[model samples]
Target: MTTIALSQEQQLALSNLCTNIQLWAKELGFQQIGISDADLSSETERLQQWLGKGYHGSMQWLEDRKKMRLNPELLHPGTRRIISVRMDYLPEGSQQIAILKSPEKAYVSRYALGRDYHKLMRKRLALIAEKIKQDAQAFIPELEISSRPFVDSAPVLERPIAEKAGLGWIGKHTLIINQHAGSWFFLGEIYTSLPLPVTEVITENKCGDCEACLKVCPTAAFPRPYELDARRCISYLTIENKGEIPEEFRTVMGNRVFGCDDCQAICPWNKYAKPTCEADFQPRHGLENSDLLTLFMWDEQTFLKNTEGSAIRRIGYELWQRNLAVGLGNAPANPDIVSALTSRLPQASELVAKHIQWALVQQKNPNRKRVRKLSRTRV
Candidate 1:
């Protein structure tokens, strides 16, 4: 990576600009902001090994853009620093485990309970980028602060970058966990050419002997501490797989219709997790407390209406119905659930029909058990 030769006076100006940037970020509703030099060399091998093992499942894009993830300069030319920001997204009154334990209710991941975060975070990051461009012109009139903002839309190693930026250490679940903020937040990044001083990596790997996150995964997604085998991860199976929910994991999937949160919910540090102040992050359409059968009954038009601005809309109506069918199957056998599953089968695509058939069999068996391993310890 080429280093920009900035004058000593310009360096001082960059440092001062960072201070104002943080204040501006907080005003824009981001909980925290940290800056890191654009060097992800430390994570290159680990990322390669994870992808080599095919742990990313069918997410081939991770491997497709291998070089870009390791080199920030490749993402935005002349990039020298990355500004990583986090926003708490855990909705207030989140009955995460309660909904999971209820068998009959759908347990959408807390992050997806509200409107999609991409637009919100991207808009905020773009504001900061514009602010930097305007502010830097005062110091160096010719300064070209080439910049780009990313929110899960890129192949960037968000957790590693956030950890380097002093935001948090990556917990056992591979999610960034701040000592003070837990893991219930969203991450956004601004790749730029500014020579900003890197934020000190103060947060240590406090996950130390505690493996509660690993133990709580119903499908045993963690092959080892600090490593996630996405193939077995419920989040990947339900959201990213875009195919069949393996039979082995379907029974253990419980009532999680969209994405799973067992790892985050069971983390002891999450006790420190705060509810989000952003109304946009709050649950909408009664999604936080909805029943599996109720959600499964939604026709395509209703599904589109309810998930209008929500993150759940990306999976399309087919996968949404597919996941809900699995949740209904894990739900206790009820004539209502049975009827819902039966009603959707004839109209369901072959992919969804298979899950509906699998669900019908579960509904027919009165002896079926949910066998959920995780319990609600936080509430």
Candidate 2:
């Protein structure tokens, strides 16, 4: 292989090369691309505070590798610049409000309905990294340093890096949201030795006075505008937290079987959000607007087969059933829904059985309409 010791002229050429790379990235489905230095001290402090509050719940991995998450060089030896890219992932016509309003229907967050984003984003980032490698090879017969691509796999503080790279500012909901593209995007990072010039300006916070995301949370998961209590979060209860979901959150959970999107769905800026061009992100198995009992009836084999490449598969079949059971409990009482609950109760795990029993009680009381209100206490 050829090695290039970049001189003044070569450095200038590399800068121009980076601009071309951004253009190419845009062509290949990235909405925006930015470069930034790997300083994440501010984000590290915020993480520490959030963890100190016990908001991370059982996700002890956040406590591990304190330094590595804040420093890119700790993860990748020669990392100098981080190339951050955003690809919008919102699927079109995912009637969120209608599903949330309908107590009988389940509401899986749009992102999880399709294929898992980790593999898809990593593939694209790898392709981008490969292009950089080829460009370097042509310029300097031997560019010894290599580029490594990352999706949410490592200690990489993706949002802060993206913020510095001018992708978007972290909203009160703690999601990075572009002014034009909104918050419906997947982020990817490429750690490289190549010293790309950092983006001149970071995005200014556009979340001024708008606590819409904070107020719209079904579980009141936010401690304040910027902080989140993950234990109380429905997304955490339904997906990340392995054991039984706390009793308090079940009723308010409504029909959200997988992840909750109440915050994003209510965000006024999301009107600007663009639909994804990637067919991989399109909803599968009619999950975007499925009935609670319909999804609750899927056996383990059917669950595994249907959610083969989906992000929802990570929660496993039991938790899937557990979450759907909660959704079923919150659904308005019906004989069909009751029969479905009764059928699953015998086969369910203790965690799922508890929720099924709750559903049965709800089923027996045919007159009560389950109101959509979150539990005040953290699960």
Best of the candidates, TM-score = 1
Candidate 2 per-residue C-alpha lDDT over 20-97 given as tens digits, one digit per residue, 9 for 90 to 100:
888889878888899998777777678888889899899888888668888778888878889999988888887888
Each prediction's whole-model lDDT (CA) = 0.89, 0.85
Q: By lDDT, who's the top model here?
A: 1
Model 2, which residues run further than 4 Å from truth? Answer: 1-6, 140-143, 366-369, 375-379
Q: Per-residue alpha-carbon lDDT of model 1 for 195-226, expressed as tens digits?
A: 78888767789998999888888888887878
Instruction: Quote each prediction's TM-score.
Output: 0.96, 0.95
**What's the distance in Å from true for residue 319, model 1?**
0.6
> On a 0 to 100 scale, what is the lDDT of residue 113 in model 1?
85
Task: Give me the displacement of residue 358 in model 2, in angstroms.
Answer: 1.4
- Looking at model 1, residue 66 earns an lDDT score of 86
